[model samples]
Target: MSPQTKSKQRVRDHGEVFTAEREVKAMCDLVKDECDRIDSRFLEPACGNGNFLAEILTRKLATVKKLYKSNPYDYERYAVLAVTSIYGVEILADNAEECRKRLFALWDKEYTAVCKKSANDETREAVRYILSKNILCGNALTLMCVDENQKDTDKPIVFPEWSLLGTKLKRRDFRLDVMLKANDKPKNGQPSLFDVPEEIRKYLSINPVTKEFMAEPICEYPPVHYRKVQENG
Candidate 1:
């Protein structure tokens, strides 16, 4: 019985029952290895205040801290990847907003501890932006993201896919509907979903980053080390 639900009306209307923390941890533990993987992506279709996503972020951040504690640069890069990997779609606007806030708060607390006084404002802003894009207010059933007014204007839910290339973060946006359609087998002789030609499938297995295979990334953000900023000033 999480207090996030406004009243019995919401529960009855939306069937919104927030999972308790104890249960969230237990369920996530079942996929402990994946949860610990810093780059493993997780999407909660009906995320409510982020009980599960928060726990997943905690686990992933712990691994980030353990592996990259000696190198803040690598730690920050992978930490951002871990945050960006998480995606959520909530029908309720408040729940979607709260989920984003909760995930950001969890990341911020650990990020501050790891970076200390060396934390950069740009990096923080980057995390905020990632969360804003990752956790969206939309109907997962319809696979459409909505505007502030919660009206669907035929716009598909688009999510940015992030890949860390050395010191740079490469991002590509994909429409949810198109992604879902990638699973369908059109015909007997048709190429597989994602439009990957059969001849290229073998090559794609080795390197999936081929531009032809993925939608162009919306933007890329270079690494911004806060400690460096302070030293330069």
Candidate 2:
């Protein structure tokens, strides 16, 4: 692993400190089952260089290999699903890019070794596209995308909810701020966010079963074959 701090200045400026590998392992062990599930979703709000996410992906891939090693088609699909389940937000653009490259390298190495003759470029590119969407350069606390200088942008951070339906993948984009707001209720005597003006309230949806207010996706794409998401989704 790289040193915990790139420089003293970075530490002071951004409170950046990379977690050691041993500690990352121990913390993940606390939710070991989730880490092993290929489609289980995980988000690291302050994922500096992806120390924790890397380990979780490694474990999920291992489980995929164990179950699908004999069948290349199954292995490729599940491995891509594993990659799609991981997400992160890093305040620094450089760190966010590094985290994405690091994850892709780790996944590609295992994929190449296992699928060997069966691996194809289309599936690999699909994984790349998923990572591009799943990881973001942003401030998790403010839930806004960040600029190169780490200033919050006027644009709110948006993330796609990716789900697989057999060989097809479905996507829905949600604003981070709206998602957080939907998860909580207004405190006593406070106004409900859904009670806003009609223009903004249009973004909220109701769960038919639970009868609860939920954040409506800003946009959604029809399910497309996993290999064609980047091109057609």
Number of clashes found in candidate 2: 0
Candidate 2 RMSD computed on C-alpha atoms after optimal superposition onto the true structure = 2.4
Model 1, range 84-202, lDDT digits (tens) per residue?
78999988899898889888888989888888876777888788888888898888888887776657757767787767666566665766665554544445534443455443233
Residue pairs with backbone atoms closer than 3 Å in model 2 (clashes)? none
Model 2, residue 73: distance off in Å is: 0.4
Best TM-score among the predictions, by candidate number? 2
Candidate 2 local lDDT, 98-178, one digit each (tens): 999999999999999999999989988998898889999999998889999999998778888988899888899988777
> Candidate 1: deviation at residue 8, Å?
1.5
